[model samples]
Target: MSIQDIVFVTGNANKLKEVKMILSSESSKFNLINEPLDLEEIQDVDLKSIAMAKCKQASEILGPNRPVFVEDTALVFDEFNGLPGAYIKWFVKSMGLAKIVQMLDSFDNKDAKAITTIVYADGKGEFHVFQGITEGTIVSSRGPTTFGWDSIFQPKESTNGQTYAEMAKEDKNLISQRGRAFAQLKTFLAAESM
Candidate 1:
């Protein structure tokens, strides 16, 4: 199969790094060309719509026939009925981690979900979206605080009770929402080649 170059539109260094780590391997079919575009993210109730819109915008800016993908991650509290679903980034920025945990203290249920939505635009005006959800709970910050929300979410799949920030990058990626979403993307790309 011929190698394909795909543009990944994102300004976030942490996201880019995590994506690279998730997608990197000798047999990978894509050469991810990073173009950090400052595209306006439309506020919407649907997280997939936000990624789709961003992917289309990136395709328009990059011109026709260039495959491009954009990703959006959300933290949804089950009790809040997905409050701050697409607005998670802003919430984290304004309230900080400590306050976010405090906000959930009033509720007995701390159940939350981590979601990653990835949209790919084929540059022919066709867009495809892939999503991955990790069932988790919001906990007090318990690990490295550098990465966004990693320290606060404990995936139910974790037997050791380690947060994403506490686990090794490889271990985290194996079960992370982004990792699962990218796995679908990789599968799609592989099938596209055949």
Candidate 2:
């Protein structure tokens, strides 16, 4: 697919902004369509399934020519057997990050990670899936610069045990789950354009 023929479908403005910034920095030649293709949120599901479902929904709305991209991310904690893996959104909205931290306070393991899967479909049965993961541990307090659960999640071997929110934008973009997934997408698009 050509760069001018791509569109990103999402409802989160923050995520859109971050994606735009990343693409811009790479001089990525693609258009971003901010239209929100509605998808019902299914509880207690796997990340890949959620991504595929969203991709299908967006493709149906976009018709048979235009391509649409959708992503679903989940925070999986090793200590809790990946509790809230696919339910991170509801958990965050219902309990907030603070309460989640409190809930994990007594767990024997703090190892956690974020898994992001992006699905791009051309509405013609042609689709691609890209995934990114950031290995980290759960922190007790929120960081000043991070958004969402950023302040409460620290990457492994991080300096001062800081989370993505505590790291600079450049640094975060280098190792973030979204960053990794987008990088893979960028590479795929670049190759396809060749």
lDDT of 2 by residue, 1-194 (tens): 44566668888887888888766744556666777766876555578878887778777777757877887888998877877787877788888888888877887788898988999885457989999999998887657723578788898846677787788777887888888899998888777657
**Tens digits of lDDT, candidate 1, 1-194:** 67788899989999999898888872467788999999999988789888888887888899879999999999999989887788888888999998998889999999999999999987677888999999998999998998888999999998799998889999989888999999998888878867
Candidate 1 error regions (>4 Å): 26-28
Worst 10 residues of 1 by lDDT: 22-31
Model 2 C-alpha lDDT versus the unseen true structure: 0.79
lDDT, candidate 1, at 14: 93
Clash pairs of candidate 1? Answer: none
RMSD of 2: 2.0
